[model samples]
Target: MANLILYKQTDLSDRMTVNRSHQANGGMSLFRTTSWKRSFVSSWLLRLSMFLLLSLPNSEGKAIWTAHLNITFQVGNRIISELGETGVFGNHSPLEKVAGMVVLPEGWNQNACNPMTNFSRPETTESWLALIERGGCTFTHKIKVAAERGANGVIIYNYPGTGNKVFPMSHQGTGNVVAVMIGNLKGMELFHLIQKGVHVTIIIEVGRRHIPWLNHHIMSLFTFMAATVACFFLYCARRPRMPSTATRRRRQIKADIKKAIGELELRVLKEGDKEIDPNGDSCVVCFDIYKPKDTVRILTCKHLFHKACIDPWLLAHRTCPMCKCDILKA
Candidate 1:
């Protein structure tokens, strides 16, 4: 019975791993995702960002900085100007009647490796939105092609490999896509609305998006900087020549050693007395936190809990949970 149960759990875990890899590697989203971790993390990050921004007191009238894109259509025999909120952005801001053009690419239709190549075959750019395929290329190439082919801008479609994403080159340049980046989710929806002759005026306000779970970009930079400086100062006070290259090299070597030890420890998850459950529920070896809802399993003994809880504990005892006997405790 236990064997059957374990086998089922293993199969389920494999499926979960595949699903997670897809989402993590940009195969799905929370609303469209099939797993728990990816959806949970994305939702959590968004919520946390909003919470932090809201928590701050509003001061200097510029409370809560955000990015907004006002889109207006520029269509005419020659060039129709005055899009939705183009001129309204700010007068004397270097934009004339037709400040910029928008590229309406087909969403979920293209890959970065291969893009719509026929966009420049003297094609009539009369579609409400352009249908671009992604493949064998970078965004820059697609945009460049669109520009040379008389396209005001471009929109790249979403694919199974690339995550739902966008990129606006405001501080960069006003080339293809008219200096704006947008995701397929919104663009595709907007295209349908426009095709139906429905006026699609929108104010895309990019709010402060904070990620709390893993250090993505800014968080990673700050964390590493802080950790490095903290270590340097802590060692400085202890060693007279701590600020020297020799001290730094020694510390670096220690870090490498620690990493090797950690790998070995993980590879040998079930060691002797060195392993024990200091945390009642969490994994002792990996220091990974555990939840009560986790699966409980016994290693020979009937005593059971989260597999993670036992695996880490087994790093040392590696024996019957109840008897405290060592079988693989070496």
Candidate 2:
């Protein structure tokens, strides 16, 4: 989703750091920082917060990454669905933005399904993890079948003659679901491993070049750095503007909100729930749009919400909408 000044690959190497070399050539550091390290807890908390921030679902073009393989520039339907930038290879590809790489169901053959069907299994899917063929049908048809079968995840394979990085994916034609593609040359092996019950690992990597938030958080550290330099100058001249009481109060309020929001989001993401947590997690029972004084109910999922808001939602679905935690489960 980046409108980057694409620096095409002139030479690919693992021995050198791109950021450092670029700094040596271009005079500014896009990938390097000189800030002093914080404490261990602070560093982990910062990283964890960053990872969570980038992991949230994003609209197309909002989630940006590098052009690792000179792939087609997609506008409406140029790039078929990639599980985000993390699914591909290369140092510039980041893991933070990816939903997860997908492995298509093995043994489902496309040519076998032709001629009005010699297919044994009914074309209907029974699991959320769907199996789809590569040929004869449009990718949209494959996704539709999988989704109709209750799948939130879709895996599309390359047809027999499908070439790597050739066919483009168009999202304008399908439902909103996380889908990943596997070319015949690369994905065939992983397809077989899945057949052996090997748990598929959805590898998401956020390389230094791929993180956009580094620009924002780096400002906080840099401001702190600027303040330190100002203090040094103040000591030399013995004159400095004191921080106003209002400024301090505003900072305190902002910090309180950030701390609350970050901790609450972390809990919600980790526990996989959305209802109000009566266990001192929040004021409301999950996010049932509780009123100021509405009575709320808490679930074992540690989520709380307005009793009024959840009665109907739970009637049809017992899981929290935010985290997918089962609210009805004990």
Candidate 3:
């Protein structure tokens, strides 16, 4: 019996140990699953937020319309004006109207590859402009050099690779001057005109061009807002009616206004009336003196005006014109 009792006690101890181990393992597994779920949810939320932020319209750095370049010259007996491709305006550049005679560097008149590092001023000595090709330095550098030499504006033609496609430019820190770029083809055309001794005048004018993506987003937002407003109105129309306090107050106010208007006193202006001096009192609407035998209406606030004038004014304004007293409140 003593051996059997010892055996039974050992068996009970082993069973309790196994049970405790299984419970601990189950708790650890549950904790690991919870941790993974939390991590996954947090990562998903972060990614969603980033996507939303990037998807919104960029209010800063809005795209602007490009300026137009108008080039004019005399072809034999007739005058010719051709529009050239325009590029971006420089930052802090003046948008005011700039008109001047086009000039090229002394040795660079016929050469498209002219670096224009040393440009010659025009012989006329009036407000003249510089024509340079895009190469050898930054846009700001070329513009700044030309501006220092007293050029009213600087026109840079695109490189050969850009063909006839004009693009906007950023020349920050450059002096206040009008700077524009043209396509390679337009530049060559103007260059040849100058080479042929044809005097050309170019005009830079500010113009508007719509950005495709911005217009699309604006239309989409407008449509969405209109639909939302329409849906809200529809919901209100379909919603069950309840007499709220505001609605009841508005109705009471309307009724009071009608009652006040019905009880308003009417009088006729005469020469000897003590209430009104026809010569002194003028109709505010017509700015005319009140005449004898004229009919008028008196408001609750004791302000008087011609019936034809005050009736229409009260119907529209719902208050005394001079005193601004509310008939509904009275």
Best by lDDT: 3
Q: Candidate 1: worst 10 consecutive residues by lDDT?
A: 85-94
Q: lDDT of all predictions, in order shown?
A: 0.40, 0.41, 0.67
Q: What is candidate 2's CA lDDT for residue 116?
A: 30
Please provide, for model 1 over 246-323, each residue's C-alpha lDDT reduced to its tens digit, 9 standing for 90 to 100.
878867755654443233322222423223344544443345544434444444333444555555555544454556
lDDT-better candidate, 2 vs 3 = 3
Ranking by lDDT: 3, 2, 1
Native-referenced Cα lDDT, model 1: 0.40
Per-model TM-score on C-alpha atoms: 0.28, 0.28, 0.45
lDDT of 2 at 312: 56
What lDDT score is found at residue 76 in candidate 1? 42
Per-residue lDDT over 133-246 for candidate 2, one digit per residue giving the tens place of the 0 to 100 score: 466665665665555545555444455544343222443455455444445544454456555644343433333234434543464366556656755665455323545578
User: What digit string (tens of lDDT, one per residue) describes model 3 on residues 223-295?
Assistant: 5566557656655764446566788897886676667777899899887776455457677876777777988
User: Residue 300, candidate 2: how far off, in angstroms?
Assistant: 99
* Residue 210 displacement in candidate 1 (angstroms): 14
